[model samples]
Target: MNESGNPSQPVNVNEYDASHIQVLEGLEAVRRRPGMYIGSTGERGLHQMVYEVVTHAVNEHLAGHADTIDVTITADGRIRVADNGRGLPVEVRESTGMSAVERQLTELSFAPKPRTGYWVFGGINGLGLCVVNALSSRLTVEVHRDSHRWTQEYEKGIPISAFTRHEESSGHGTAIAFMPDADIFETTRYSFATLSQRLQELAFLNGGLAISLTDERPERPVRHQHLDGLHAYVAHLNPYPSSLVHSPAIGFTSENEEQTIFVQVAMQWNTRPPGEFRSFANSTRTHEGGTHEHGFRTALTAIINDHARRQHLISPDDEDITAEAVQQGLTAVVSVKLAHPVFEGCTRTRLGNPEANTYIQETVREHLAVWLDHHPNEAAAIIRHILNTSI
Candidate 1:
């Protein structure tokens, strides 16, 4: 207003003082801005809450602490997640005199960061159990450990009572049941199909992990476990399975020991478009393909083009096939496990680590080249398919 030569009113500079600097202690920040942590207050966010809890259990399995995870949608609109794993430590903390389980649920500071040489997919966005608890109207946890059973209850992120210990339990594990806060979410109803697809993908992504989804609302239960892992995943995603250029998917894994990164790839070409080309980092789907995807595509195009020229399938003067052409009719899954994966955003939809590119590129280059050279018939068929698609 002053620059425009208009009469300006007196401003209260004191109005923007220390009182405006409100500090949100404990889990209050999550509740004040649920969308900032959960991405939305709609159906997607509701599902994300379920994913966070399930992901925690999956991490246990990834760390070799657990093997089986069971998820149930109760008739009363509550989610129950149980796992056969080493339960959360119940030892009392010296600073707060609270058990580890209570601290994990009540404080956001407990979220673990990506450390060296450990494979985990929990709280990568700095939101996990605590966020789940904050946005939940009612949450209960049961821990079977230390040769005894421990239990606790919370209402709207506040502990209703102290943790109680019971008689010795037979085995060690953790079970959590939570009801999403109606005030925070647009809808508390869970989607069975959406949750099933993700759980199935997780099972395929992490081989030998058993996961079961039970809809207690209707008493429907299904189990998912894949020893063949990504190979089975690619086959399942193939839309043109009958028209595959190769009978079985080509799968391989490579590791960069110094960097502590592991890449696993499974690929199969078909005679159709709109095929699946999925990528994941640290067991989280990278919806927006990032460095890892870039590396995979670059290596694939180079290998195919070089092979075509060497085999005289294409003249030396012919332009190298584009990455798009090489990927046409492709059904592949690229999964990379990095101890310190760098995701581009809080949503974790894109990978950003530069080292991931080199790791995946080299892995694909070496393994794919060998596969093509070993299987001339399948390789030629794949090349022909690409050429036809280009035409």
Candidate 2:
């Protein structure tokens, strides 16, 4: 045995040579370390695969190039995502000598190219569709664009069929279908309920964009389209209709001069304690929150305290209502769309943009104050409920 108390199978220092080094080409790296791209081999990672594909379609909707998205869990255990968007470019690239769609599915260096004045959540890591292609045992992409249909098939990121162009039969769109590689994932099965909730959330985040989820196993399909956007989201979060302090969720939308930053806010007070608070940056849920959430909480507490003092609900000598007290029964959703959003944390679940903080604070303070002034009865009820609950 070695002094380290090991197996002592071999002690050849020269054997640790350069030949052992491996250079994974194309999507090979993604197959080698799946977790680094998708987060895990568990259910969470499985869902992330769906998100990566869906987010691509959602980006099209965000860019005003698409309005409808469809996701299906096939009876054969495959997944399909389709969108009525400007389908992927089919022309060959001069630099790579490969069609744009083929390169996107086979290479890790290609990030999604959104049109100018638009923002997207995917492709930040430049993996995008390539990661999905690499991790899937089988993948097929169908594109309808410029009065023609293009189709390609892949197996574990390698092209198994020629890229074929056929006669045009429908409007422009993109569709992708894949079977998760059992060797790379702990399980290939998916939860329809998990997918439904997220697709519904996406529909709410992108108003007027219809998103549908179908499970071919049961042949059940559900669709979500919210014209009211975050207002609908806030109402959905507070399921107890009778417990609301306000009749409808207070909602507003604001944008900066360059139109680079857009903020949408919706909030409602409820009788229930520990109400939900959700925040998103460029359609990505900020689970851990960050500067935008901080700005929201700050503005909300200050406005409520100021209003309470003005109405003599609390004396000048009396202690101000604490932030915890203010949030006791508050349900709110804050969504910020930044041209260049900064995210932090290992999971990339927090917005870290400093400008987001200032913009959110000013926007919330201005809009919420106007809302309170317009709905004096609701404002009073909300404050009273907060005071009663905090006691």
Candidate that would win on TM-score: 1
Model 1, 341-379: lDDT tens digits are 888867778999998998888998899999999999999
Q: Give the range where candidate 1 is weakest over 10 consecutive residues by summed lDDT.
A: 115-124
Best by lDDT: 2
Relative to the true structure, candidate 2 reaches a TM of 0.94
Give one digit per residue, the lDDT tens place, for model 2 in 234-340: 98999899999887998999999998889999999898888889999988889999999999999999999999998888999999899999998889999998888
Report every candidate's CA lDDT.
0.87, 0.88
TM-score of candidate 1 against the unseen true structure: 0.95
Which residue pairs clash within candidate 2? none
